[model samples]
Target: MLIAETSEGKRVNLSQLSREEITGLKKKKHYCPGCKSEIIVKNGTVIMPHFAHKKNSQCFFFSENESEEHLVGKKLIAANCEKYGIDYELEAFLPELQQRPDVLINRKIAVEFQCSPLSIARFKERTINYQAFGYQVLWILGTKLQWKDSCSSMQRQFVYLSKNIGFYVWELDISKKEIRNNYFLVSSIWKKFYQTQLFSLEKESVIDILQFPLKNHEEVSYEIASKVACEKRIHCWNQQLNQKSKSSLQLQEFFYQEGLNLRELPVEIMLPSFQSVLLKEQELIWRFQIYQRIQRDKKMSYQSLYRMLKQNFDKNYPLISDCQLIKYHLSLYLCFLLQNKLIIEKEGYYYPTNKKFTLKKTSQEFLGIPLKYGMINK
Candidate 1:
């Protein structure tokens, strides 16, 4: 931890002191703010000067041995806070919540710089606890936790929703000394897509950057899938069904139970949307479910459809405290359906169109038909 309480109960920050000053202060007794246990100062030429708990100390706050990257990231944020003249506390422990954020800004915003893997249960617990106490918690992920081609279920929990940016994640690059605002994140069956805006820690204020989207509204444009791409994916699904892949078998079983052929389903089932990320099942599976429902019932209200598909939606995004994401995605899906003429909306109810829903026999046949809906604009 960066801050430690002195013998006289005064808080001292080792980072603010020079090497000589830190060496002199090491002579006096200091204790941890969380457990009030004696903590020794470790001033090495390589690592940052900080306090460490004694071996076998049972303090939750100082239990884990912090990595060099974690230490550097914390120091960078601390320096940024100072540069912006923001009132903050380093490693401040909240006795009420029994939690210590990496940096507490104005005692309201709890900034956590997570460099290591955290279980979903623990992440949710800390997030809910902070929110319960009326403190907005922001989790800035480290390089280790950043997603590559696709977003993992654990990484999705870090996504925060905002009016300016649909959904976003904050990433700190210790190597570059910059923070990346990866916003408008959308997921596909095989990949995750998003736009990134980098903010140099030397140039931007961390507090101001957090609120940048709110102040400046920017349009996010993304293509869900091209007709050719969708056709290719459908072909891949057909191959999976032929091979009886586990997931494919499950989806096929559902289609069989409904007296429908999975491969013969309408091409519209392959359509993707930004909100489809909320679905726990594959987009095609749930989309087909909705398609089948409308086909059987002739008409359905949005409320009834949402209720039916509630089980299909993922409800585990703990960091997204602002919006009802499931409903938001469903609304978008309905809008997309309406746009594609697959469904007609009238008086808050959706009815299947007279237009026939059929799949082409070959990829060439599918590509011959012009797709009216290719991308979703946000």
Candidate 2:
């Protein structure tokens, strides 16, 4: 259907209507989106339009550049695909594909580009539908929509995934261009696919995987360090070497090293400083580490990885609340890491880099600000 094309450069669509129906509606009310008022008809055409308020009429919402907000994301995704040299296309707001997706990339993949709401049900439903078609789906949640008045305005969260319905959620703060969190909704089911070794990664995958945990500020608590080592399946030699006193500064120093590729020690051996061995948790971690390697190697099965993740979470973190809720915090932490460039996703894997990571670098550049002096100082 032909959506509204306004003189003010606004394009609104009633995707449900046909071209004929759109013409019919145009006859009844020459709606001025700016004023939410009906326009008067002169000889055979609409007259000079001015925004007018109708009694008891709710004010028309003049949302800022829906096209820009929606399409910028698609453009970024497109660029990312292009940088990786992948194929894609934008659907715009064409009625034929309204229910389809905002952008159709690779024909086998669909994208719903939205910048509002944390819709749990909607996301779950869409993931299922797109996945059924074996299409990889991505939801670019607009974390940029915050109120100007509220200084406490929170950034929106973004979620991206492939279709298999495996409750695994990895949060990426694209504002910072980092992988924020890596979590499983149904860890048990995730564990199952994981155990089956269902993920393939390219050389770049190693970078994304290893760099993920380093994105966050260096918090080398046993748990954090363990998760980092477990996620990357690579040991931090500096952390291991500085075992006498595990300080955040020490961990930071370890990351500052020039060119160090740490190896994965078997689950049995505890590197010098690690006090507690992740025994029971080792299986889940082992699967995850292997999963990372698979993503890095590009020779793993996604189905197998999903099964392992699902089975592990179900058998272990069975509480729906804990599995879903508490896990988000951990994931968010990972996202912070990615935002800072400490972690990157080059191919299929997430890894750390020798380069320092900072979200301020990218977002500020996008906003045309070298750096907000006061904010940076603060």
Candidate 3:
């Protein structure tokens, strides 16, 4: 929405011009860069001056309604690039793909500012198009990102396009011009997200982000990440307990009927995985499902039981995750069960040790355990 097509077919960025110039340019006719429909300049005092299509224009960007925040965000990045003397362009148009990036640098890197919720499919399509044109795409999400504050089940989802390619959520405090870079390194093994606090670019002369070494950055151990995830999940449940989310209320009632308390879930059930984050069912539900199944079956035929669970999960939690997280968690859960002597395996089958046993530790107590998975340099 920031870029408009002039009568000469050249892209005009109103943000670069002075208020007097923009106010004067509003008198002339303009057109939407994306739709090529007649456009008008919105020279508002509060929002940055940008072009908007005429009434009822069928432009996709019109429906999106470019936010003031989006306007200011891209300007900030452009300013930073200029300050550092990096060669850049604003909304560089690609004639072949008919795509315009928010900021293009050195005719190679195209930066897309995602201020609005974009479809995963569209996001991929844009990236693919950029790659096909030999341009490296860097996705920077606008600061609209929000995760549920309470439920552990409502864990934050960090979309990593690959080990090297991932989404960047830029927390730009416009007033202070501070950018908090919260980078995530996903565990391909567990499919769990691990966040790394990268160095600030507040004073950098050259942007090394071009190197994109996210895969090499290790910030937290699997143990601590799981603990934090568990805390968030519990917080969500506690919130639901107060607000009465039907599902949480029902889960609590089920636990109560089973002679159990929601808060005091056994330590063995706090399973964590990166890929399994898509699952809407709380970790408690799935973990308890396994526990009850093992208790009832006396001994579990690991292969058959795993296959059955996998089939159900394929339906409940799609194969959307990049890694085999569900499978890893199942195997890891079995390891935990064996380690605690909660279950014993004989001839490739697992059997419960005792009919009934008092809990030695709770999920809360297990938080103290040091994370031990992968090459945990952190």
Question: Which one wins on TM-score?
Answer: 1
TM-scores for all predictions: 0.85, 0.29, 0.59
Model 1 TM-score relative to the real fold? 0.85
**What are the per-residue Cα lDDT tens digits for candidate 1 across 1-378?**
788998889999876889999999878999999999999999987778888998888897754588878888988998999999999998899999999999999889999999988898989999999999999998999988985666667877888766556667899998899999887666654566677989999998988788765755545455534455555666877999788798878877887887877776566666553334444445566677777798789989987877877765555777763235655555556656776578898887889986754433322210000112233322
10 residues in a row with least lDDT, candidate 3: 363-372
RMSD of each: 4.6, 18.6, 7.5
- Give the number of the best model, judged by lDDT: 1
lDDT of 2 by residue, 257-333 (tens): 62322333332222111211112224334333433444465443433434444454532221123333223322332
Residue 257 lDDT, candidate 3, scale 0-100: 89
Please give the distance, in angstroms, between residue 257's alpha carbon in candidate 1 and its true position after superposition: 3.5
> Which is better, 2 or 3, measured by lDDT?
3
